[model samples]
Target chain A: MPKLDFDTINLGHGSGGKLTNQLLDSGVFSVLKNDLLDQRHDGAILELSGKTAFTTDSFVISPVFFPGGDIGELAVNGTVNDLAMCGAIPRYLSLAFILEEGLPMTEFWDILVSIRNACAAAGVSVVTGDTKVVERGKGDKVFVNTTGVGTVHPKAEIDIRRIMPGDKIIVSGQLAAHGMAIMSVREGLEFESQIVSDTQPLNHLVKDLLDEFGNNIKLLRDPTRGGVGTALNEMARDRDLGVHLEQRALPIDPQVAGACELLGLDPLYVANEGLFLAVVSGAAAGAMVGAMQRTDTGRHARIIGEFTDQHPKKVVMTSGIGGQRIVNMLIGEQLPRIC
Target chain B: MPKLDFDTINLGHGSGGKLTNQLLDSGVFSVLKNDLLDQRHDGAILELSGKTAFTTDSFVISPVFFPGGDIGELAVNGTVNDLAMCGAIPRYLSLAFILEEGLPMTEFWDILVSIRNACAAAGVSVVTGDTKVVERGKGDKVFVNTTGVGTVHPKAEIDIRRIMPGDKIIVSGQLAAHGMAIMSVREGLEFESQIVSDTQPLNHLVKDLLDEFGNNIKLLRDPTRGGVGTALNEMARDRDLGVHLEQRALPIDPQVAGACELLGLDPLYVANEGLFLAVVSGAAAGAMVGAMQRTDTGRHARIIGEFTDQHPKKVVMTSGIGGQRIVNMLIGEQLPRIC
Candidate 1:
């Protein structure tokens, strides 16, 4: 790192001048150094073959720093997971930051470190990036937009359209941790246990599951902004299929459930950063669960439900008491700017 | 398009609820509709081969709508130019939007229309996108981040490192139009002719120069945020070479020059959305200029400078008065949030 310090970012840092270079060199480039970025060109040039997955997401998560992770790691892992959801072996990412003036340099530096570590954890490189500054109050502290590109592994043929009736729907680990975690901090609720954001890089866990299941894994989606219910509901309507979810089998962290109850929110509608739902063939569902359970991030993997032909284009939830009800996707945002 | 209508975007539009689907299905989904995005999946899947270019840029240009263009086209073209600078045949783009809760639906629709036309004009597909909403005052109307991927042509060997002594520097057209245009609107200053933004897509113009010159074309850059001077200064420093620019040879529209004179700004340092610089071998300088001049976006193209070994990594300007001076990269923003 260069031996220059500014308490916070000034307009000059985004001026594309000496200060911009100074800031990038000292804070970002020093930590995320790589060959493609070192080229310092407008874009990164790479060699590739076969199918590629492309995705983009901007993290404007309020309270830039949250329990278990900050916006930095979330930005990196979010895009990486989007690509991974498509069975793409996450390889490269492009980061863009729109920072508010007067943001503490120390805060920015911490984010840079998180991004660097997250990229390493995800086995990807941030090959290109851009930064812009907005006047104070016009922007949140820092909003990150990350676009990722990755090559799809040949053995993986994942697609929602490929999902058929009788396919088992398995959710990786617990649900609602990420959303409830944000709610906890935002509402200043002190529980026996602080709810931690489930923000993590899921590429390794995905790789392991894909390796064992191969083409048997029909679909994968990280239940993020709209949570598992919203993601599954959309899939149901998009593919014109019925999904039957069992409440007893659904894995939820007791702490997250308690927090949601206090907030009068449904855990099914809360978001998750590290967890994903997988639709696997019945023949391979047991093996898929086993593979996920072997990984640290997925040790709580369970078969939550399956696709059914009874109610086409709808999702039905079975209660523990044998009662049934329609599980509606969220109608409006219960929590705004929650990532 | 769906028949539902609303005057402005409400929190529901971003709620991932019925409103979110309605807005997307009617407005965005109707205009930039394509297969990869229509899949309703988390990410787009594409097939690729050979060398590819990956780049990203976030547009926070204030006064979303301006003289020559709006933030919509700028978002598309800015990304397209980044890829074009890499000697890549621009193909696909992913657009992400962060809209404020109270933005007018009509205004958003107009920008959506502009984005569609720019994409068609540039011959690139909008394959995937994401939308998020912040509270009314938390965001400035809308901020867009576009990430693009393209296939590199076989013959082009564009690189700043390829630049060497005796190379000729050619600019695509008149400078300072973009920055000046933004300043005029923001400061509420009006010129006799109303200096419009030179915000056109330059992919075809770049392709023409590359097709004719091939590897003879050593380097390419778009003078967007920091203008021609900053772009050249960066190239000079990056390659450790001297760039000698001719003041009289520089192309500046009469109206743009007049506006600059009134504002006490140097045309050299103002931004240009549609302009680019080409460093070609001395032997092919004339041919390259001639090629650029014949194109619509490059009709005013001219030779602005040349590289020399005398002062490595410095840019010197030779005025018509036969005086010499250093042209520095902008130290601070001349105009902020001007794209």
Candidate 2:
């Protein structure tokens, strides 16, 4: 194949089809050959002598700093939570920043401090980093990408494939707090109560649940950009199973619910930062819920739904008025930069 | 010390001073609690069980695709060269992208194809990756971060710390090609000869040199962001040595030199994507230069300078007119996003 010219980038580059494959073939894969990248999986799977888990996330939030959290905190916790959701003990992280020229150094300092505090609170360490500044106006204020490496217990076998019919789904805390916080701040929405983003790292909370419930936990996910609805839909699709959610059983703060209602948004589609949905065996669901309730971060834990065999690849939500509606994948972009 | 707040960032963060220290202490270091990061050195000192080298780079170049290369190729080659600089055999890479929403899918796909091709040429692999989208206007078209791992031969012990007073500086190929290409396109500078970027992976060239010189190579740097002059200045400062360069000995493509002169830019400060600066003991410099010349990428390699014990942390240049002047560190930001 001919090598890609460096003249310009066309939209076909990102299509995930022939052109995408060509770009990868002509430009990237040609330079750094390796086995793991050849697999082309969603993530890399490694065999390790010691217990370890690795994950990464990138923060491109607009305005750099926003209500509740900024890129710094988001970058840190995002990776930490990815490890936590996997039943891994979060440990260290690699932080890399792409800064735009003319970005105020003071602002970068503020974000760095936030990152330090977040790490301290989460009990993880920042081990490595790379920083680069792009031309002015060519980049946003800053973009943060973080990669985390953690240790997982040897016996843990958590996987989405373990989810079965009748398994109960429990949410860790209030939904839509994060998305509402960002929306309210960005749009200057006035409300009786200010909605703070629930962007806390949940490694400890995850540890607590795993310590009590052991292997009963089938799967875990942090409903972020696409929100809880999208996360559930993905789970259903991945397992070839149906999920039935009860609107009345879902937990939502009044401030977040009111904000979503006012904006004509569904709480189900609003992103959550410090919340997670877990699938546990039917017999262990009650015990898991009880364990979750004992932790402050999981005080709002509730049995929102259950996995089912009917209507695989679909999420059906029983509305407050007793009508069932299919919760399909997100049709379009909703709240932006809620991460 | 007071904790750093996330509400806003300030300029002092990158100053390498009190605020910078606080930012690391309160934000970054607090979250990533690792021994390597705690050291706060120019680069982390990692110990591997086997012969291995690890390096990472983030490409935020504007115009996603530029005159000679794009983010995809740059990410692959940048990391590959970093590992090679450490005398490691280039192998694998992890590619992660932070994409702006509404970026044409076509462009994204093209970049992937470029990545695939670049890896094939470099004999590396894209073992793992992550994809994220931010709201329109929140991010640039795309940002790519690549982390690479390679294995070093057991006998190699390349280190900048080994640089001595009687060391010779050799530059591979022409200087300022990459930077000139970017500037010309960005500024619409018309020239009789259109200068294309010199972006290419150099691990193979590096292999040629290492195979010939063995452990005689003292230091290697790609001369990226701040350019050849900046990279040399950094080495001088880091090694507590003095550098003297002969202007007449430097190899400059006439077109690139003309572009620099026309724009009132210094060719020495312009970035080069496919060139590297190596400092070797005077005794081994001749053999090393011969090895470099054997490779197509290093055909124009030239001996440009030498290191000395006097005038530590200073770089002096013998001008073409026989006048001597100090080459100081870059005082302020030069052309942004030239990478």
Candidate 2 lDDT by residue in tens digits, B1-339 = 234353223323322233334444553233223333321211222222354454556777777888777888888888888778777777666667776655654566567678877887888866545555555565677888887656675445677788889899999989989888888888988899789888898888887777778778877788776678877877887789999999999999998998999999888877788989988889999888887887789899999999999899899999999999998654444566665
lDDT of 2 at B339: 52
Residue-level lDDT tens digits of model 1 in B186-295: 98997788889999888887777777778998888998877788888889888999999999999998988989999999998888999899999999999888877887
lDDT of 1 by residue, A1-339 (tens): 345567788777777666776676664456888888853578999887899999999889989999999999999999999999989899999999999999988788889899999999899999988998888878888999999998897788987789999999999989999889898999999999788999998888888777767899999999887788988898899879999999999999888888888899988889899999999998999988887788788899999999998899899999999999999878777888888
- Output the worst ten-in-a-row residue range by lDDT, candidate 2 chain B: B38-47
All candidates: TM-score: 0.98, 0.79
Full-model lDDT, candidate 2: 0.72
> Which residue runs of candidate 1 sit more than 4 Å off their true CA positions?
none
Q: Which candidate achieves the best DockQ against the true structure?
A: 1
TM-score of chain B of 1: 0.97
Two-chain DockQ for each candidate model = 0.77, 0.08
Show how many residue pairs clash in every candidate, following the order shown: 1, 76
| Least well predicted 10-residue stretch by lDDT in candidate 1 chain A | A21-30
